[model samples]
Target: MGYGFAWHPVLLNSLLLLAAALLFNRLAGRRYPHSQPAAPAPTPSERVGVSRADLHAALAERGEVVDISEDDLEDILQRAEERSHQRRFGALRCADFMVSEVLSVSAAASSDKALALLRDHRFDALPVTSSDGRLLGEISLRELLAAAGMHPAPLVGQLMDTCPHTSRPDDPIERLIHPFADRGVAHSMVVDGEGRLLGLVAQGDLIAALFREQLERPA
Candidate 1:
C-alpha cells in the first residue's frame, strides 16, 4: 500500500508539469504567430488627381459658387489659394503698390499753391509736409475751399487736417482694408520709420493691382 501511494504522488506531479508546458507553448505560438506582418497598409499616392479632389472639396466648403462648372471652379480656387498664400507670407507689401512720386505741398505753402498742385495732378487730397519732408498733415480741396470761405488766411496749415491716417511702406497691403472700409478713404500716406513721407496708396492703385494679379495668375 505504501508503494502504491508514493507512485500516485509521482504520477500527479508529472501530469501537472505536462499541462503547464502545453499551456506555455500555446501562448507563445499565438504571440509570435506564423503569419507575416500585414503588408503595410498601402501608402497613399501623391498625384494631380488628389490635388483636384482637394480643390473641389475647398470650393464646396465655401458654399458661394453655384453657377460655375467643377473644372472652372477648381482652376479659380487653385489660383486664389496661391495668391492667398503669397499674401499670408507678406510677399506683397505696401511699398509694392504705393506711388513713390507723391505730389505734396508744404504746410506753409499758400492755399492758392496747394490748390494749384491739386489741379495740376487732378488729385483730391495732398499730403502737407514740413520743408524737410516730414509729414505734418493732409489737405483736401474741399477743406481748402471751406477754409477759404470761413477765413481770410490762405495758408495750407489752416486748411489741413492735423490727424491724417498714416502707414509704413513695409506694412502689408491688408492693413489698409479696414481703414479703407471705415472711411470712404481713397488714399493713405505712406511714411518712413521717421514719420517722413515715402509714398502714397490710392484705392485705384489697389484695385488695379488686384486686377493685374488675377490676370497674371496661371489659367
Candidate 2:
C-alpha cells in the first residue's frame, strides 16, 4: 500500500509566514534601498582652535602626510598666527598702546641726574624736554656713560640724542616695528605736531597689546 504525506496545520502556517516575510523584505529593499550615512559636517578651525590633532586629521584626509613632529607643527602654526595678527592690526596707531604721562628729564639736568633717574626707575631711556614741555631729545645709559669721563659733567642737553626717532600720535604702530627691530630701538617718543612729547611707546608695550588683542579676538 502507498502512503500519502500530510503537512500539520501549524507547520504549514509557519512555512507560509516565513515565505511572506522574505518576499516583503525583498520588495521593500528594492523600493527603499539603503544608502551610505551622510558624511559628517566638517570641523571648523576657528571653532576648534586649530589643534595639532585637527591638522593631522586634515592632512590625512587630503592624503598629504608630512614627516614633522607635532610640537614643531604647533610652533609653526603659532608663528603663523602671530604674523596674521600683526598684519591684521598693523594699522593700529601709536597712541593706542603708548604710555601717557611719561616720566621725562629736563634738558638742563646734569648727566649724573639723568643716569640716577634711569637707575632709580629701572628705565632704559628717558625723554629730555625743554622748560616749555617741548621734546628736546632723549638720554640713555649709553650717553650717560660716555659723558662720565668728561672734564666737566655734561648736561643732558649736551649728552642726549638730539636726533632721536620720533612718532606722531596718529602714526601706525607698524611704522615702528621694522625700525625698532632693525635699529634695536627700545622706545619711540610719541609727540604732537609741535614736537611736544605726548607719550612713549616701548617694545614691551606693543607686544603686550598685541597679545591682549589676540586673546580678545572673536572666534
Candidate 3:
C-alpha cells in the first residue's frame, strides 16, 4: 500500500506527458498538413484490366457500332462509368502522363519576378534554373512567403530542399512511389536516363488521372 502511494505522482506525470504529445502532434500537423500519412494506394495489377485508353475508345464510339459487339462491350464498360470520376487508388507513371512543361525561375531573377510567376502560373511548384535552365532548386508558395525580404531575398538556388527525384521514361512506377512516401516534395520531375527533364508528376496529376479514367469509361 505504501509503494502504490509513492508511485501515484510518477504515473500521473506519464499520463500528462502522453496528453501533451497528442496535443503537440495535432498542432504541428496543422502547420505542415501535407506531411500527414496517406492511405495505401492500389497497385498497377489491380488497375490493369480496364486501361484508360481502352475506356476512352469505348466512349468515343457515339452512335455507330463499327465491328464491335455492343452488348458485351457496353456491359464491361458500365461498371467504371457509373463510379464517381474522383480518384481512388493508383500509382503514377512518368512517361504515360507526367507534365513535361516545367517553368523555372533564375537565381539572379529578382524576388518580384518569382512572385509574379507564382501568381501567373497555375502550377503549385516551379523549379529554379540558370540562364540555360540547369534545374537548380525549386520554389513553391510555402517558400514564397519569405520573398518580401523577411529573410534574405531567398534565392531559388538556396530554397531547393534537395536535388529533384527523377526517373527514367521506362522506370516501373511502383518503384517511384516508394521515394515519394518520405520526401518533402509533392512532385517529382520525370527525367530521362541522361537526367534531362521530361515532365513533372505532381500529386494532383495522379489524382487527375483517375478522374480521367472514369470520364472515358462508357455509360
Computed on alpha carbons, the lDDT of every model, listed in order, comes to: 0.75, 0.78, 0.60
Better of 1 and 2 by TM-score: 2
- Off-target runs (Cα >4 Å) in candidate 1 are 1-90, 149-151
- Clash pairs of candidate 1? none
Clashes of 3: 2
Q: Mark the regions of model 3 whose C-alpha exceeds 4 Å error after superposition.
A: 1-92, 150-154, 179-184, 210-219
Which parts of model 2 have CA positions greater than 4 angstroms off? 1-87, 149-151
What tens digits encode model 2's per-residue C-alpha lDDT throughout 1-219?
223223556668778987787788787774323468795654333344566567778888989668887778866875676466467755578899999989899988888888888899998889999877889988889879777767677889887888888999888776665556556778889999999999999988877876877777778
Residue by residue across 1-219, what tens digits does model 3's lDDT show?
678765688788888887787778777875322366785554343254454455457668765555656556645454443232223433335577687777777777666567778788766667776665455666777677565664456556656545666666665444443345434447777766545566777666655665676676678
lDDT of 1 by residue, 55-75 (tens): 667777988767878778655
